[model samples]
Target: MQACQVEQLLADYGTEIYRYCRRLAGFGPDGEDLYQQTFLRLLEADLEPDEGRSPRALLYSVATGLWRNESRKRSRRAAIARPVELDGDDPPPLAGGEEPEAEALKAAENRALAAAVERLPDKYRAAVLLAYGAELPLEEVARIEKLPKGTVKSRLHKARLLLKKEMEARGYGREEL
Candidate 1:
C-alpha cells in the first residue's frame, strides 16, 4: 500500500484496533503500544489490506499476534501486580449536548464492561473480542481463531452469558449489556 493508503487505513481502523488491543492488554498504555506495533508490522511487512475481506478482522489478527507475543515476554520477565485502574483518567469528551455527568457515567460503564471482559477465560475472551468487540462476523472470528463456526458460536454465547452475569453483579442490569 502507498503512504496515503496506510494513513487512510489507520484513520479507519485505528480506533477499533486500539479497543481490541486495550481489551486484550487490560490497560491503555500497553494497548497503545501494541496498537502501534500492529500497524508497524503491517507497514514493515507491506501487506496490503484486502478490502474484499474484513479489514477489522485482519487488523485484529495482527494485533492479537503482537499482543500474545509481547504478553509471553512480559510474563517471563515478571508477574503483573494487579489489574490497572481506569478511575483517575477520563475518556475523551463527547461532541455537543452530552453532559459531563453523563460522560462520566458512560466511562464508568465502559470500565466495568472492560473489567468483566478481562475476567473471561482466554478462549472465550478471544471469541468475544473478535466477534463482538471488533464487530467481525462469527465466520471471520472462527477463521481468525482457527476454530469451527459452531465452536465460535458456543464461545460467544457463553461469553455473553458470563458478561451479563458479571455486569449484573456489578450492579448493572442485564439489559444494559
Candidate 2:
C-alpha cells in the first residue's frame, strides 16, 4: 500500500483499533505498544486493499495475532524474571449532566467488567473482545478466528454467560451490565 493509503487507513480505523488493543491487552503500556505494533505491521505488509475485505477487520486480526504472540513471550519470561503485576488506573468520569453518584457508579461498574474480562480464558476473551470490544459482526469475527459462524456465536453466548456470572459475583446485577 502507498503511504497515502496507509495514512488514510490509520485516520479511519486508528481509534477503533487502539480501543480494541486497550481492551485486549489491558489499559497499560503493553496496550499502547500493541497498538503501535499493529499499525507498524500494517505498514510492513504493504497490503493492497481488497474489495471484499474490511480494513478494520484486517487491523483487528493483526492486533489479535500480535497480542497473542506477545502474551506467549510474556508467559515464558515470567518463568525467568520476577513477576510484576500492573494494574490499570480507572478511566476518568464522564463529563456530563449526570449526577456525581451516578457517574461514580458507572465507572465502578466499568472497572468491574474490565476486571472480569481480564480473568476470562484466552479463547473466550478473544471472542468477547473481537465480537463486542471491536464491534465486529459475528461473521467477521468467525472469519478472523477461522471458526465456523455457529462456533463464534456459541463462544459469544458462553462468554456472555461467564461474564454475567462474574459480574454478579462482583455485585453487579444483570440489569446494570
- Alpha carbon deviation, residue 33, candidate 2 (Å): 0.8
All-Cα superposition RMSD per candidate: 6.6, 5.0
lDDT of 1 at 143: 75
Clashes in model 2: which pairs? none
Residue 14 of candidate 1: its Cα lDDT? 79
lDDT of 1: 0.77
Off by over 4 Å in 1: 78-110, 171-177
Predicted candidate 2 versus true structure: per-residue lDDT over 10-120, tens digit per residue: 999988888888888878998899999988887788866568999887888888889989989988999899697786643443434654687778777788788788888
Candidate lDDT (C-alpha), each: 0.77, 0.82
- For model 1, how does the per-residue alpha-carbon lDDT over 84-115 read when each residue is reduced to its tens digit? 54773433333346446877767777877777
Once model 1 is optimally superposed onto the true structure by TM-score, how far is the C-alpha of residue 41 displaced, in angstroms? 0.4
